[model samples]
Target: MDKLLKILSENSAYTTAQLALMLNEPEDYIKAQIKEYEDSGVIRGYQAMVNWDSVPDAGVMAIIELKVTPQKEKGFDEIAEKVMMFDEVSSVYLMAGGYDLALVVKGDTIQDVSAFVAKKLSALEGIVSTATHFMLKRYKEGSVALVDVEEPTDGREMIV
Candidate 1:
């Protein structure tokens, strides 16, 4: 990956001037590159990884592994598109293992998520079976860590 892209991926909050300074390039060049990336769809969108646990009434999340019979001619693309249209679905991925598709969904409660899987997901045509796993905790998401470690009480910080 390009250095600029790597930096942006790790932290998209950096200003163009800051990125230019870090990369030792002119600000105009950095701006042009970013514009090109956005126009070409290389830079999809910027996002902040939030620790939902810290928020009150945060919804539950789950990963559903689905086995499906592919539609003729369309393969998995058509099914994948249909699955992604649901409002509860956050992500959909085609897998190479035991399942044909992996879907990440969010809902107000476990029961809500179960209902979605049972009524919405399973009801879709070509779906053979589904196994849902609710997320108990999120230790890390993307490049952000959810866990916060306190400073060493003994005055010697451990570095590993």
Candidate 2:
């Protein structure tokens, strides 16, 4: 399991033969395990990681911090249901400390986004308050490998 997991996580597109070589297992045996896992719904499917930044008209993104009145009995389940109703919401998470729910959403424009906020999310029952912060810039995003940050120097060059 450890060997299989490492290979899967590091480079998911590796072939069965490549994985067999890495794990020091026979190709047929490794293939059988993969098949079994897929059959039982453990291994899902292969995917191509596209760098979607190259695409135009990608739209605006924002992170909305939501404070909601959780149902005394049902907890956050009810608020979560209302959040899912809005198509603009890409993802929602139950957060810690400051807010109850945090939404990562995308919209064509700021007005379109604020409309969703006014019509659907803010008006939803049990919603106490909301604070939205538009994502102005993304130096890095998604599963893109993070780069190392180096020490900064003074802008002016010292004369020798």
Candidate 3:
């Protein structure tokens, strides 16, 4: 990955001036690079990773693995694009294992997700099977720790 992209991925809030200073480049250069990235679809979008567990009633997230028959001419792209159109879907990816596609879906409850899988996703053409896994908790996301775990206090004296 490019240094600029790596820094942006770690923290997108860095201003052009700050990024230029860190990269030892001019602000105009940094700005132009970022603009080119966006124009070329290299940088899709910026987002803040939220710790939903800390918020009450933040709803549920499910990882749905799908087995499908890829169209002769279109392959997986057709079905993947159709799946991406659903509002409940947040992320979708093509996999190389038992499943053809994996989707990250959000709903108000487990039942809601189940219904979506049964009624919407499974009903689509070429969809052979699906396995939905509900996320009970999220300890980390986007390489950032969402929870702090403290060491047990067993009253042991420090050796150092």
Candidate-wise lDDT, in order: 0.94, 0.80, 0.94
Per-residue lDDT of model 2, residues 1-160, tens digit only: 4679667755688888999998899999998988887899887776565433455777788899999988988899888877977789978999899889999888988888888888888888899999888886655544543333453667888888
Q: Candidate 3's residue-wise lDDT over 13-129, tens digit each?
A: 999999999999999999999999999999999998788889898899999999999999999999999999999999999999888999999999888999999999999999999
Candidate 1: stretches off by over 4 Å: 150-160
Model 2 earns a TM-score of 0.70
Task: Write model 1 residue lDDT over 34-119, tens digit each, in one string.
Answer: 99999999999999889998888999999999999999999999999999999999999999988999999999999999999999
User: How many angstroms is residue 150 displaced in model 2 relative to the true structure, after the best TM-score fit?
Assistant: 11
**What is the number of residue pairs that collide in model 1?**
0
lDDT of 1 at 127: 96
Tell me the lDDT of candidate 2: 0.80
Residue 135 of model 2 has an lDDT of 80
What is candidate 3's CA lDDT for residue 147? Answer: 79
